[model samples]
Target: MSVDLSGAHWFKSTRSAAGNDCVEIAHLDGGRVGVRDSKNPHGGALVFTPLEWDAFLSVARGGEFDRP
Candidate 1:
């Protein structure tokens, strides 16, 4: 299911790097999630299902994608 994020409330990561090097997320319509870059809000947004977003966050919190 697709959702429009033209008026979503975008929020940046509180732990983001100093130079705005982080992604932003918004609660989109239809119970979906919207993600984009804080550095380029106008670039575009990618929508994800709630389950998908939760799974992604789980791995992310475990440092699965952390760059050492």
Candidate 2:
């Protein structure tokens, strides 16, 4: 699925500090979402469907990707 992200309004997590190492997220059409590096806005992004995003969030909330 191709999502036109030309009008995407990307935002980063509030927990992110004043560093270039951050990811930006944007809500796309058809309940999709876009993720990209904040320091590289012009770069490509990883688009996720609603279901995929939800699953990822669930795992994230469970600390699956936490660095211990």
Task: Pick the TM-score winner.
Answer: 2
Sequence-dependent TM-score of model 1: 0.77
- Taking all chains together, each candidate's TM-score versus the true structure is 0.77, 0.91
Candidate 1 residue lDDT tens string, 1-68:
55667779998777877787788889976678998988788987888988998999899999999999
Please estimate how well model 2 matches the true structure, expressed as its whole-model Cα lDDT. 0.94
Task: Quote the positional error of residue 7 for candidate 2 in Å.
Answer: 0.2
What tens-digit string does per-residue lDDT give for candidate 2 at 7-63?
999999899998979999999888899999989999999999999999999999999
User: Candidate 2 — worst ten consecutive residues by lDDT sum?
Assistant: 1-10
Clashes of 1: 0
In candidate 1 the C-alpha lDDT for residue 19 amounts to: 82
| Native-to-model Cα distance after best TM-score fit, residue 22 in candidate 1, in Å | 2.2
Q: Report, for every candidate in turn, its global Cα lDDT versus the true structure.
A: 0.85, 0.94
